[model samples]
Target: MMRAFKSLFWIEFKLSVRAMNLVLFGLFSPAVVAVIIGVIYGAKPAFDGAGYSFMAQSFGALSGIGICATGLMGLPLALADYRHRKILKRFEVTPVSPGMLLFVQVAVNFVYALAAMAMVYGICRMFGGGWEGGSFLYFGLSFLLVTVSIYSLGMLVASVAGNIKTANLLCTVLYFPMLIFSGATLPYEVMPPALQHVADIMPLTQGVKLMKNAALGLPIENAAVPVAVMVILAVICVVVSIRFFRWE
Candidate 1:
């Protein structure tokens, strides 16, 4: 079982690397958006929020949202399309299990997310964004939470989507609201009361909240709420996604 799983994983990885378009879509688009935002508002303060540096906060928030858009959107659409085309069904006829296929896809996407994040960090650093948080463990944990949450959510969407087009459409529909109100591009406090209420339910908002707290070395309690929300989302998505996932 382990050997079969490893073979299946490598096959998926090689396919993903050869699919240049998926790499571009999954990795490049978010980096572009981050660059545009950094160029436009890189020098400006993030907001008037007390004790928070604007660029640091913005870069942190941007990294969180970029992960969401890339992972949840690009990863699921590709998976759904592969399944819709019976690619997964072909694998099913082999010694490979459906679970292994899902795991491999998730692993590939996590790598893509990490690469996109590196681009975000490097560009932000070039543009004068500073990392005030001294602890690598803190950053790793926060990044892990957000990445797991988004990846699980992507799996959930892929299970439900019948085709690539539908998955693409749905992912976009789900992403924009979070970007707008979740303190990704815009801070939640500046939003109107109604919008703030809506944004509170967004997983990325919670993800951003946790990321900011970690980046700034704040008390764990400062991140507890958002981390809890992300964990819940991840759990729910994983259960439902596995239950409903289709190979063709």
Candidate 2:
């Protein structure tokens, strides 16, 4: 079973590499944006009492972007394509299960998302914008929670989508709004009060806030709400996806 999983994972990884859009958006784009932001603001000093530099905040936000791109966009599209092509149906007659294929897809995309985050962090550090946080453990936990929650949402989309085209459309509809309001694409500070309230309700917004605070080494206040939200969201989505998943 382990060997079968390994084979499926490698195959999925290779297929992902061959998909130029996935490579571009899921992997390279965040790194590119980090480099650009670092070059532009690398010299700026940390904001008053903000603990970390502006570049760190930007990188933190960009990390969420990469996570969202892979978890919310790439994963669903790939899984939907598999369903559309009847790949999942074909797996049912073999020793390998469709559940294993889904696992492999999730594992491979999680790696991609982490690699993208690492690449963005490296670029930021190379440009003199390394993280100023003190607690690696806390940051790791926050990152894990955000990634799992977001990926669960993707899984929900894959389980419910009827075809690749619908998956892509749904992902797009979710992606742009999350990107815009979550401060991944736009600065959250500059958003109007009403808009900020709306953004506050978004899961990614809370994720980004948690990540930014963790990255900045700031004491996370009122964190219970976001943490609970993400945990609940992940659990519910995973349960629903598993219960209603379609192999064909």
Using lDDT as the measure, the top candidate is 2
lDDT of each: 0.74, 0.84
The best candidate in terms of TM-score:
2
Candidate 1 residues lying further than 4 Å off, grouped into runs, are 47-53, 220-222
Q: Where is the poorest 10-residue window by lDDT in model 2?
A: 43-52
In candidate 2, which residue pairs get closer than 3 Å at backbone N, Cα or C atoms, i.e. clash? none
Candidate 2 lDDT for residue 45: 64
lDDT of 2 by residue, 47-95 (tens): 6675457787776788888889988898888989989999878876888
Per-residue CA lDDT of model 1 for 45-83, tens digit only, reads: 666554545556665686776577656776687788788
Residue 65, candidate 2: alpha-carbon lDDT:
85
- Give candidate 2's whole-model lDDT: 0.84
TM-score of each: 0.86, 0.94
